[model samples]
Target: MAASQAVQAKLSFLFKAANTQFASCPELSNFYLHQFQKTADHANVPLADAVQRLCCARCGALFVAGINCKVRINSIDASKRRKTPGRCRNRVRITCHACRHPTVTNGSTTTLLKAVASPGLSVSVAPPVDVPTGKKTKKKKLDLQAMLNQKKAPSPSSSSFGLDDFLSSL
Candidate 1:
């Protein structure tokens, strides 16, 4: 069956169940159904399952789950002394219903939990470059006579006083 059709079927089942469970109140049923549909659409999963997972028995806040879930294996390079060949071992992502913790499933067991610390896990955020404010430092104006005298003092044929010589020095 198509994914959309499966989703609709599951939603209908949840709606009916919710209505029956809530004493068949039309307004309550519609409200619950709307909430279930919204949660399912956001999570891209079955409506009933998503509703069951998010709705806390104690406090009724919708907890977000299955975020930043990934499974990766780093292959060490013998020559370079660095783990370069990073590969994803599993593709199936799972989220815990009670705590909203994301995990990567490998077979029946969850290999990587959402809280496990790993190298290269933190995204590299470049620091903002220092922008020059409107304030400009006052530069001393060069004396033309002094400059000309200094140039004359140096040998003209030597070509050491040129812009190219200054650049090369830098």
Candidate 2:
């Protein structure tokens, strides 16, 4: 398959896996979706692809292990987990498996999915899906009459210096 198609297929798998993994864990899903949105907002990937690549494993910290992207998972102890009130259930605290950095979780996966999957979600901002860039056309033919009319138009100083006189002087 072409490079673009391959990238798309990998992204599709990541999104499908994320959907399946997060289906039962809404909180984890929301957290990952939010992280994906934030990362995609800043990263090199197109907004849509960034969103699609966002995934997490049973433990939080945004999974990208099998995906084409370069995200690394940092390990942390489950004992360090914290509890924040008014948050989604099944919330687990952990650090980056790779970097060992600390982060917090908020109940957001469901909201993220709703926002991304929604038909009305800002279609103008998202990139077009599955259109081959190689097939796109550029350059348009100019209108001959329009070009002729522009050529026929007089210069600003033409009226001050009579056209016939100017031509004669030239």
Candidate 3:
């Protein structure tokens, strides 16, 4: 289901307020964050990925690296690595100081890049361009209206054939 725009706006405001008050008043920031989570849950709307990563799922506290939470890249265990050398990879772990909950996520290249770049920095990727290949020079656009207006074929099971006819044929 689609999210309500009004609820989305409210969530944005709450997150911003929590972020702004985090340094000066941590309690107030936590309160705002708690409310933000509650509002999203009440409205049955999903939080944005950025916001979800920033907030502590256990305590509803804002996670500022080195402040409220500790962020690190955890290497695979020696035994596990030995069992599967090539498949083993590091994982990004964020531990909440307030709740002592550790959240582990994949240590992808893009995630490492973002962590090393800067704090509170937004990363945006440009839309992919259709490159000219020998087979196709241009991208084909779908006609949504025509597709919607097309008549759908009935299923074979929906045909006007009785069970008695099948038994007789058998």
Candidate 4:
């Protein structure tokens, strides 16, 4: 999957470069874009999903950190590190210039970097680089027994307006 992801990223870069070089040639740009998509789809790379993290969702425009997109990483909280220590914190945000589409991805920087770096040397065919929705996920079931044992939050004030109250007031 890493190898395929790397291939797709390379193709994206190629098409982006081509698109700029042949700005006047709309057909050439469209050809490059479609060719990229076709190659990625054939490889089963999920390029659009990967590209969604780094490209414009609306226009399928390429994102260059400072050039075409605004790439920024959210601040990480030091206090609640262990309580929720997953991709939920310190998200990577990519805002595209062409369509003004803002994309927020959790902990996807490493995979993107790996894909870009993979083309230089040997392909990283090993697992670990994964798309957001992969097959390894498991359904987390809540422990009802534990929930019952734990003290619940105090109920909201009873004075709060009810549906009947709002309807009557209206």
TM-score of each: 0.18, 0.21, 0.56, 0.37
Number of the top lDDT candidate: 3
Q: What is the C-alpha lDDT profile of model 1 across 5-81, one tens digit per residue?
A: 66666666865655565554534544565565664666576434445544332222233333212323343344543
- What are the runs in model 2 whose C-alpha is more than 4 Å off? 1-17, 49-170
lDDT of 4 by residue, 52-121 (tens): 4544555555556876679888865767544654524577788877667788877644445566776567
Per-model CA lDDT versus the true structure: 0.47, 0.46, 0.78, 0.61
lDDT of 3 by residue, 1-170 (tens): 56688988888899899989998999899999999999889988877777788888878899889988999998877677557534446778899999899987655544457566786776678989977675453322234544544524334666665675578699
lDDT of 2: 0.46
Candidate 4 or 2, higher TM-score = 4
Error of 4 at 66 (Å): 1.8
Looking at candidate 2, the ten consecutive residues that score lowest on lDDT are 132-141
Ordered list by lDDT, greatest first = 3, 4, 1, 2
Query: Which is the winner by lDDT between candidate 1 and candidate 4?
Result: 4
Q: What is the C-alpha lDDT profile of model 2 across 1-170, one tens digit per residue?
A: 13355455554554455567664775555454555445434444574433333433223335443332243333333343234333233333334453454434443344565677677664356666865354342211235666777767866765576666679898
User: In model 1, where do residues sit more than 4 Å from their true spots?
Assistant: 3-31, 34-51, 56-110, 114-116, 122-170
